[model samples]
Target: MIFNSDTSSDQVQSEFKGRVSLLESDVKQKNCSIIINDLKEWDSGTYQLRVITLPRAGSSVWGKRSCPLRGYCNTLVEGEISAEAGLCVVIPCSFTVPDRIQISHIVWFKCESTKWRCDHGDMIFNSDTSSDQVQSEFKGRVSLLESDVNQKNCSIIINDLKESDSGEYQLRVIGLQMEDALTFSQKATVAVKGLSQRPTVMIPTLTEGQQTTLTCTAPGLCSGSEPTFTWRWRRRGESDTDLTGNITAVKTENVASFAKRSSSTLSFSPSAEHHGTNITCTVLFQGNVSTEETATLNVTYVKEVRITQNASVSEGETLNLTCKVDSFPPSLITWTKVSDHSSRNGTGTTLQNNTFSDSAQLREERGTATLSLFNVTAGDAGQYVCTVTHMNSTWKENVNVTVIYMRDPVITGNLRVKEGAVLNLTCRDNSFPPSHVAWTQVFDQSSRNGAGTTLQKNTFTTGDYLENLRFLVVALLLLMIISVIVVNLRYWRKSVQQGPTNTKSPSGFSNEPESLQDYDDVSNATARAPTSPNLLDDHTSEGEVEMNFPQVRFTATPRRQTTNRDSSSSHQDES
Candidate 1:
């Protein structure tokens, strides 16, 4: 170290050798300033410099006093600090003034990194001074941690931080004299980042139509400004909607010595519409800094099981039915058909078909299930049941499925019968809802009416054939003629055998009979055979002619009766 004193006996410490120096020529003008090169944080305390003068003649005067070190009025502060928006940060700062220098006030100034000085407009806080010169935004937000600056605690607390508040802060101390005032060259840097701390949200188990409360707590404890809370609901496929009007919101703040607790609680009744929707709790702080937490709302609910479908399906067509249930968590749907036969368990199982190996096909979605019966037939017709199982509850619904069908009709009776016989016939058809069977007489082309002539009844009958009365009379005459012819033929043949003679009988006999008998026999043989008749009569004549011909008589009888009687008589005779 180079000494500024004129005496060559001056000494320097080993640590300060070649690093500390004072100009001797400048000291001649009463300038004893010393320069320290490559100074470090450890070199920041008090330092003294000693100067010795020539002793007065005879009487010696000694001068020993504390030497004030120039350019040593230092301000201790952090180099950098990081803070989040909507939170608080403490910038620790402390400064010292030269001994015997009365401090007037202290001022904090914010400046950009490139600027070396801050104007009066950059002053954020001033101690023991009017606030007219301090920035309006930081007027109440900036406060000293230690109100007594005599304690050397210049640390300040900035609440409700903002992104624009990031910069370099310088501490300036104003003393009573101009030489006592100083501004620390070492400044503290602050980095205010965007709000990243989300609000804490508490949600409870919610049920449909049940009132519930949700709590939201804002982050940080600055105690600068009261944060505002907002509640919003976002439904599926829709925008967010404010729930302030529909819900009750309560805000509470508890301030302690160093921390401030701020929270909000929202109360509302939940419904099915709130299920699966997102609800957000946002906390807004000073400078429009905001943070939010979102949670999905789950409302437990259950609706009745509904089965919709066309119960009546034509045969050989497909039958489709759907069962649905609305609940918080989707319910499980099961399809079943009521068994026509007695089931061992009473509860029916899945539908089964003899023709289809895979009977009813089941398809499931979120809240609905479909049962499809392909190629439906009469066997597929029954009561179909749909069951839904939700949380711990089970619901059921059923429908009667009908398969429309009809079978070929059949007539169960004899097809042929005699004219006078009693005829009976019945028509039968197998079908759903039963078919109506009627009898109709299908007329031939020869009939005046075409096609079927509905008899309007089921049975028909015919009585005696009186239309054949004239024919019966004609038949009787022919039978009588036949009997007379037979008598004449026999008499003629007897006469021929006994030889021809002309004689008189006792009963008015005549001798001219041979020619007449021959003529009569020929005429009788020439007569046509009796026509087929419904009836015939028998009669006979008696006398000498009756004796010669052995009188024969003929009676009329119904053709059908006569045939029957003959057959019966022949059987009787044979027996």
Candidate 2:
């Protein structure tokens, strides 16, 4: 060691003794440095300074650091740099000068690359000159790392690099003295090419009739230039179209010295038409370089159920119905008859009354269901439902069925009545939506009056009536018969009380009384109505005779016929 703490070598190198000395200020600051004066061109080379720090009282090992210094002006830089179009890049660089040299400013120039060196080109950035001196295309796009410049860092960041920007770059350092200005011999080669990076897109689950937003982030994280974004949509089997009206786009920026990012958000409502379509997000940088990302849109959607069939059907006619629904991912369609008690079978058909056979068929491709009843009846009149199940939701539609039917009309009450008697008749029929009843006369017997002439005549009568004279004649006859029978019955009873009567007449008949004989003669001449056996035996009380008088009259026809036949036989015997 030539020197150590307060000690000097007795014999020192003649040229280095006076020129080299320790820097006390650097030592007080916990740094190791030395001062060398009169640096010349021959001394331009790399010099390494190393310090071995003795361990504290408790340790025995020593720590050391190697710091390198260069004489004159020089730069440390990479020979080649990689960059992408429409993005940013950083060229890391540093410089050194003689110990006493002070830096005034820095300048950067982009030049065309030649085999041996760089050709004269445009100035991209300058610290000591006005911004006007820089190229128009590169203005405000090239910036120096300001805080690092004082530490001899010549690093620069280029925003929105283009293919034309690929070239050799030179850095010049200016000092106070005219002889101190220097240009670095080593150059940085920027290989800017077409942008191959794609934008990052984030999308959420989309649903029809729902509003959502999509986010697109550009490639670079440089703060120098802001990027623009665009949104487009391409329907399945169709060309791309710009997404406009009803869509909102917002651009956001995040900038800092070390980190910079740009992004855009797109918001809109999605519908069934947007399902299975492609949506693209494109990012554009300052140099007209663009990148894009595409994603297929999948939307969940459904439509209302519809029943397109007439509900009114005539009895004994075929009742056919169809139901349909539109939806995405298809849908389950079902047909059912709505009744007080209704159920569905596993085959997707509803059964209201198992008594009637119903045919149900489903065509999944067309999303339609059909229900057919071969012969409709009153029991088939009810509400029918079309049910649709899509995704996790369900919907239904209903129709009321009407069966048209009617029965034959009927007439009730007396068909014939005595003259001047009021009669009542009722006509009725069973039918759906009740049948209309009317009585129109096709022929009038009273108006013809046994003549061929047509006569319009009106006869007032309460109801159906028989002729008065004919009724009276029949009544008189019935009275005469009843009187005779009463008299004969009295005589018979008298005879019975008087014991046996041997009285006989020339006619070979038992002689009762004159009234009895006359009753027999009258009965023989006119047909006598017969009395029911039960009536004669019903002599338990005399009041019964009167009670059965009407019955006897109505029942007298058979007896009258028998008497007429006896009279006819006697006549034949006499002939």
Q: What TM-score does prediction 2 earn?
A: 0.47
TM-score for all models, in order of appearance: 0.53, 0.47
lDDT per residue as tens, model 1, 368-465: 88888888889888888888888888888988899889999988888899999988887778777676665555445424574354443333322223
User: Model 2, 1-575: lDDT tens per residue?
Assistant: 32233345455446555555553322322223344544457656566655555455432232111123346443433345667888877776667777688888778888766634333246788776554677788877788766545588777888878888888887777777878777766677788878887876767778888888877777766766677788889977889886554464656554557446678887888888888788898888875778999988877788777787768988898787778876777887766776655533322236433434444233344677777776788887888777888888889888888999998889998979999998777788878877766543324574456543443333323231346567778889988887776655444433333333345445333465544433333222232222357435444232122214663531111112455356545654554
Give the candidate number with the greatest lDDT.
1
Q: Which regions in candidate 1 have their CA more than 4 angstroms from the true location? A: 1-79, 84-86, 92-137, 144-155, 170-186, 193-203, 234-245, 253-256, 276-282, 288-298, 341-345, 351-359, 410-428, 438-575
Clashing pairs in 2: 528-560, 529-556, 530-559
